[model samples]
Structures are given as structure tokens and as C-alpha cells.
Target: MTPEIAAEADLVLTATRAHRADVVSLQPKALKYTFALADFAHLVDGIDEVPPAQTGFFGPADDSFIGRLVDHIGKRRTAIHPIAEDDADIVDPYRRPPEVFAQMAVHIDAVTPPVVRALTLE
Candidate 1:
């Protein structure tokens, strides 16, 4: 995405690690908002109070749930980085066997709740 588009976004969630370089490269200012999907999942997992999945949509509020979550994650960012870097990518399951797909699904499943929770937090 272009820097303008990235700037407009409240958050940028990449599907995989492969996509992160492109997202972060041209848009240095977006670094705080952009996150690899799995990396974000990992970051949100340890937080004690991730807003529940019913706060509201991303915008139109005084402060969005995602904005709050991002702020919280930013505060704990240094601690979150080292542990997440190595395994922050979800495995690509394209053109793979059912077993491989299942493994990929499992990883996605593990991360989904935290992401949902963060987005939904009030």
C-alpha cells in the first residue's frame, strides 16, 4: 500500500511475514500501525485485559478498540519483540496437502481469538 493509504489506516494487518517487508518499507511512519498477523496475535496474547470482542467497530468512537490495543502493545513492545520474532509468521499452506493445511489452520486458530479480542475490546 502507498504511504497515503497507510497513513489513513487505523491499523495494517498483513496476512504473512512475506508481506511485512513491503508494508513497512515504503511507509516508515506506518511501522507502529502495521503488524504481521501472527506477530500481532503474539503481541496481544499476554495482555491481561484485552478488550472483549464487543466494544465496537474500528472507527467512529472517541478512541477505537484497536487504537487502545495498539497503544497498550506499544507500551509493552520491547518485551514482546524478542520472543515473537522467530515464530511470528504463520506457515504458508498454499498448494499443500490436507495435513499441511490443517497445521496451518491450527496456527491461525491459535492466534485468531487474541486478534478478535483486541479488535472488539471496548
Candidate 2:
């Protein structure tokens, strides 16, 4: 079920050339990643607890450990400033606003999925 779920999700994500490129670039060495289903499930439960750092929409919470995780994973900080209302670079036709991608990365880094911490290609 997990594989199926993940596969379906990936299929939806990699359907287009541009999206495929973005996904591939976000995390190139993603095959080595192996996320624990149990941990992911637990993460899902507390997922909403993690806040956004920028737009008040899933931004990082003050004094949270996610920042440390991002550092541990060696995730370079990239500012999302100048994000326009209809910014193509930040918009995902496959899902909600593209800003959510950054938000998810925070969660993935903090949780450090045993299978794949940095699935993003770039």
C-alpha cells in the first residue's frame, strides 16, 4: 500500500517534462533514500504542527528543531522572496501553490525519511 501510494504520487508528479525536470533537479540521488512507513505515518499525524517560516502557511515554528534538521541534511537555504501571486516557478499545477514544495522540504528534512532525506535533484 505504501509503495502504491508513493508510486501514484510520483506518477502524478512526473507526468510532465518540466515537472519531471524540477523533481529530478530537486533531488538527484534520490534512489538511495528509504523512508520508514511508520515514521512517515507518525509524521503525517503531526504534519500540521510544523508551521511555515515565510507566508504563515506552513512556515517554520519558532524554536523548532526543523531548522536543525535542514542543516543536518545539508540543505542550502534558498530565499523565496519576490514570489509573485502567479509566479510560475513557485506554482505547481499538480498541487497547491508551489510554495508548498518548500514547506514539504522542511518537513522531509526535519523527519529525515530513512529512505530519502533529499530526494530533490537540485
Candidate 3:
């Protein structure tokens, strides 16, 4: 992605850690907001529901839930650890065998619930 695109983004979610790094390299300023999908899901687990005002989403409400959510997740970055390295990133299943693709699906399944729950928390 271009630096401009990254700069304009509220959050960047990639399939893998390497992809997240690639985006970060293009926009170092986005490091705090960029994350692998699985990694972000893991971070979301540490967040406790807070009022909009607490997360800067109150009053006139100029901020989005995602923007505030990202801030909360970013704070938990050091607090959560994946049970395994695989938990932090889903394998790129492009041009792979059915078995490999299934593995990727499993990894996605593992993170999907928490991620979805967090997104719908509003």
C-alpha cells in the first residue's frame, strides 16, 4: 500500500505479520494502528467495555468506534501473547493445497469470534 493510503487509514489489518510489516515500512507513522488480523483479535481480548467518553467517542463524537477500539487494542499489545506463533498470523493460503487452505480457515475461525464480538460491541 502507498504511504498516503496508509496515512489516511484508521486501521490496517493484514492476513499475516509480514504483510503488516510491509504496510508499516511504507508508513512508519501507522505502526500503532497496523496489525495482522489474528494479532488484533488477540489484543481485543484484553479490552474491557468502556463508555464512549472514556475512549474519546463521547459528546460531539468525532471519532469512530474502530478508531477508539484500535487505541484500546494497541494499549493491550504487550499484555496478550498468542499461545503459539501461528495464533498471531494466518498462513497465506494462495496457490496451496486443499489441506493448507483448510489450515488457514481454521486459523481464521479461531480469531473470528472475538474480533466480531469486539466490532459489534457498540
Candidate 4:
């Protein structure tokens, strides 16, 4: 993606290790808002004060858990760094064994509930 286009993005979600560098390089300024998918999951997992799941009714979409997660993660970015370059990555399961695929699915599953709650607050 071009730097101009990257700059226009509100947030950037990259799915794997390979795409992370390319996306980060495209918009240096976007680093704070950009996250590898699993990395984001990990980041939010550590935040204890995230609002509890809500139901029934929600206000504007921007005021939801996703928005709050983004804000919290951005604030914590300076203090949090991936222990290894691959720390934020979800390994690619294609062409791999069933066990490998299952492991990847587990990783995704672990992060799904909070993400879904955050996105679907009401």
C-alpha cells in the first residue's frame, strides 16, 4: 500500500508476519494504530481495565469495546514490545499437518470471544 493510502487508514490489521513489515513500512506514522491480528489479541488480553461486555443496547459504534481497546493498546504500546519478532504472529497453517492447523485455530479461538464482545457490545 502507498504511504498516502496507509495514512488515511483509521487502523491497520495485518494477518501474518510477512505482511506486518510491509504495512508498517508503508506508513511509519501508522505504527501505533497498526497491529498484527494475533498481536492485537495478545495486547488486549493483558489490559485489565477494559470495560466489561455490554448487552441490550449500545451507543455509537465508535464508543464500543473495539474503540476502547484501540485506545488502551495505543497508550500501552510504548511499554509493550513483542518478545520476539514472531511474538505477534499467527503461524501460517497452509500445507502443514492437521495438528499445525489445529494449533493455529486454537490461537484464533482464544482471542475470539473478547474480540467479538468488543465488536458486538449491543
Query: lDDT of each structure?
Result: 0.73, 0.34, 0.79, 0.67
> Which model is ahead, 1 or 2, in terms of lDDT?
1
Query: Highest TM-score, which number?
Result: 3
State residue 14's C-alpha deviation in candidate 4, in Å. Answer: 2.0
Candidate 3 — which residues are off by over 4 angstroms?
46-62
Which residue pairs collide in model 4, if any? Answer: none
Clash count in backbone of candidate 4:
0
**Which lDDT value does model 4 have at 49?**
66
Show how many residue pairs clash in every candidate, following the order shown: 1, 22, 0, 0
**Model 2, runs deviating above 4 Å:** 1-93, 113-122
lDDT (10s digit) by residue, model 1, range 1-122: 78789878878988676677788787877787788888887788856674433344764432566666776676677875444554667777899888978987888898899888767655
Which stretches in model 4 have alpha-carbon errors above 4 Å?
Answer: 1-5, 46-69, 79-87
Candidate 1 ranges with C-alpha deviation above 4 Å: 48-62, 84-86
TM-score for each model = 0.74, 0.21, 0.82, 0.62
Write the residue-wise lDDT of candidate 3 on 7-106 in tens digits: 9998888998889999999999889889888887877864567345243444453267877787677657667655456677788789989999999999
Q: Put down candidate 2 lDDT per residue, 13-122, tens digits, no spaces.
A: 22223543444455543222222322222223322233333333556432334433332222211322222222212223456776777765554454445323322211
Ranking by TM-score: 3, 1, 4, 2
Candidate 1 C-alpha error for residue 26, in Å: 2.8
1 against 3, candidate with superior TM-score: 3
Candidate 2, poorest ten consecutive residues by summed lDDT: 74-83
